[model samples]
Target chain A: MPDTGLLLYGGAFGLILIGIAGIVLSAHLVRIIFAVALLEAGANLLLLLATWHQGAAAPIIVAGRVPDLMADPVPQALVLTAIVIGVGILALALSLALRVQRAYGTLDMHEVRRHMEQDIADEAGIDMPSSSHAPAAVQTARQESGA
Target chain B: MQRLSSALFLLGLGLLIAAIFRGMEFGTVAPIVGQAINSAAAEQVGAANFVTAVVLGYRGFDTLLELTILFTAATAGGMVLGKRSPTAKRDPDAGFILQAGADLLFPLLVIVGLYIILHGHLTPGGGFQGGVILASAFFVPILARPGTRMSHTAVSTIEGLAGASFIFIGLLAMFGGEAFLTPLMGQGELGALLSAGSLPVLYLAVGLKVGSELAGLLAQLSESEAVD
Candidate 1:
C-alpha cells in the first residue's frame, strides 16, 4: 500500500505540474486561472496525503490506542496556509479579470494590449523614435512635466 | 494537443508522487506527527483530537493564515460577482426531490461537523474539517434558495470575533506565564473529549470562523452576477 499511496501521491504531483504548465502556456487568462485552481487543488490533496505518507506515522498519539497512520502536521499547516492564499489569489484574479473586461472590450490579452498601447500613449505622451522607445519617451515626459 | 497536454500532466503527476514518496522516505515528518499525538500533555490543548492540536495549538499560525485566505476570498468573490446585477439567476429548476433531500441532510451534516470540531483534540479531524462540513451544509441551503443574501457584516463579525478569541486565548496563556496557547488548565485525559482544555475552545472558534466565512462565500456566489 505504501507503493500504491506513493503512486497516488506521484500522480497528484504530476497533475499539479501539468496544471502549472497549462497556466504558463495557455493564452487565455481564464484558462490560466482554471489551470491554477486545478494546480492548487492537486497540491492541497497531496499535502493532505503527506500526512499519510509511509515514513510518517498517523498523527494520533495514543497511550494504548495503537498508533496507525501518522503523517506530519507541519505540511498540513503549510498546505492550509497555501489553500487560503490560493483562495485569495483566485478571488483577486477574478476581480482583476472583471476589471480588465470592463476596461477593454475583450478579455484577450493580445487584443487588450493593442488597445492599451493607444491609451498608454495618450496618457503618457509618446515623443521617442518608435513604439519600442515608449518607455524612454514617457520618462522624458515625466521629467518635463516635473514634480 | 489535448491528448498531449493530458499526457504531460500525467507524467508530471507521476514525478510529483515520487517526490512525495521520497519525502516520506526521509523520516523527518513522521516522528514529529507521532510525538505530537502521543504527548502526555495533549489533553491541555482543549482538544480530543491530535490533528486539532497541531492545527489550533502547536502550529496555529498556519491556520490563522488559512482563515485570512478564506476571508479575503469571500470578500473578493463578493467584489467580482457583486459588481454587476447578473441576469444569471440561480437555476430554480432543481427537482423537489433533490432540494428536499438536501434539506434533510443539512442537520446531519451540522451534527457531524460539530462532532469533528469537538473531537479535534483526541482524534484526526479538527475545527477545519468540521468548519468546512458546516459550511457545506450552509451551501446546500444557498443552492436551494439562491436569492438568500448572507449579511456581510454579520459574517465578518463572527469571523473576526472567533479569530480574535483564538489569539486572545493564546495571549491569556502568555500572560499566565505559559508559552502562547499552552493550555493553561487541563491534564491530558488521553482519550476523553473534554480533556484538552483550551484546545476545544480554540477548535470551537475555528469552526465558527470557518463556517461563517464559507457561508459568506457561498452567499456571494449564489447571488445575482457581480458586475458593475
Candidate 2:
C-alpha cells in the first residue's frame, strides 16, 4: 500500500495547483474567490495530514481503556481554528467581490480593470485641466512606445 | 498561450512541492509533542476530549484571537453589504412545505447546537462547530421567509454580550489563577458533565459569539443588493 503521508501531501499539492490555475486562468471574480477557497482547503488538508499516524485513535480519551496511539492535539487545534478563520476570510472576500461587481457592473477582471483605468483617467483629467496626470515614468514609457 | 503558461507554472509548482514532501512518511511516526499531550491531557485537564482541552484549556488564547478574527470579518461584511438600495427587488418566501419544515426544525437545531457546546469538554464537538450549527438554525428561517427581517440591534447585542463574556471569563481567570486563561475552579472527575471547570463556560461563550456573528453575515449577504 502507498504511504498515506505521501498520498495526502500529493492531494494537498494538487488542490493548491488546481486552485492557482483557476485563479490565473479564470476571468470571473467569483471563480477567483472560489479558487482562493480551494487554496485554503488545500492548506488545511496539509495541516491535518501532518498529524496523522497509523493505528492512532482520535484525541478523545476513552473511559477505562487507555489510548494506545493518539494523533497530535496541537495541529488539530491549529487546523480547527484555521478552518473557521478561512471561512471568515472567504466571506469577506465574497463581500468585497460583491461590492466590486456592483460598482463596476461586471465580474470579469479585465473589464473591471478597464473601467477602473478609464475612471482614473477621467478623474485625473478633471483634476489637472492641463497636462495628463499620468506619472512621469508611465508618461515617458508611453511616449517611447508611441515613438 | 495563457493555458500553456498556466500549465507550465502549475507543473513547476507541483514539482517543487513534491520535492519538498518526498522524504516525509505518513501516519508511521508519532509526534513527540502529541505523546506528551496525550499523557498529560487526561491527568491535568480532566477533559475527555483532548482537542477540546487544547482548544479551550491549553491554548485558550488562540481561541480568543480566533473569535476576534471572526467578529472582525462579520463586522466588515456587514459594513460593506448592509445598505439596501430603493430599487432592489426582494426575494419571495419559500413554499409552504419548506417553510413549515424550517419552522419545525429551527428549535431542534438550536437545542442540538447548545447541547454540543455544553458537552464540548466531554465530546468531540466544541464551541466553533456548535456555533456554526446554531447559526445555520437561524439561517433556515431566513431561507424560509426571505421577507422576514431579523433585528440587527438584537443580533449585535447577542454577539456583543457573548464576546464580552468570553473576555470577562478570561480576565477573571487571570485575576484568580496564576496566569491568563488558567482554568478557574478545580477539575472534577473526568467524563462527568460538570467536570472540566470553566472549559464548558468558555465554550458556551464561543458558541454564542460565533452563532450570532455568522448569522449576521448570512443576513447581510442575503438582504444586500447585487451588482446590476
lDDT to native, each model: 0.69, 0.85
User: Model 1: how many Å of interface RMSD?
Assistant: 6.1
Model 1 C-alpha lDDT per residue in residues A63-139, reported as the tens digit of each score: 54545544555666567557656766786687677667767857775566556765887778874236455666555
lDDT string, candidate 1, B24-43, tens digits: 64222354544554463344
| Cα RMSD over interface residues, candidate 2 | 2.7
Q: Which stretches of candidate 1 lie over 4 Å from their true place?
A: A1-9, A41-56, A61-63, A102-105, A115-119, A125-147, B1-48, B80-95, B226-228
User: How well docked is model 2, in DockQ terms?
Assistant: 0.52
| Model 2, runs deviating above 4 Å | A126-147, B1-3, B226-228
Q: What is every candidate's C-alpha DockQ against the true complex, given to 2 decimals?
A: 0.22, 0.52
Error of 2 at A95 (Å): 1.0
10 residues in a row with least lDDT, candidate 2 chain A: A126-135
lDDT of 1: 0.69
Q: List model 2 lDDT by residue over B1-228, tens digit each.
A: 556777888888878877887777766666888889888988788888989989988899989998899889888988877688878888878999999999999999999999999999887898999999999999999999998888889899999998899889889977875677878677899989998888898899999999989998998898886434
Chain B TM-score by candidate, in order shown: 0.76, 0.95
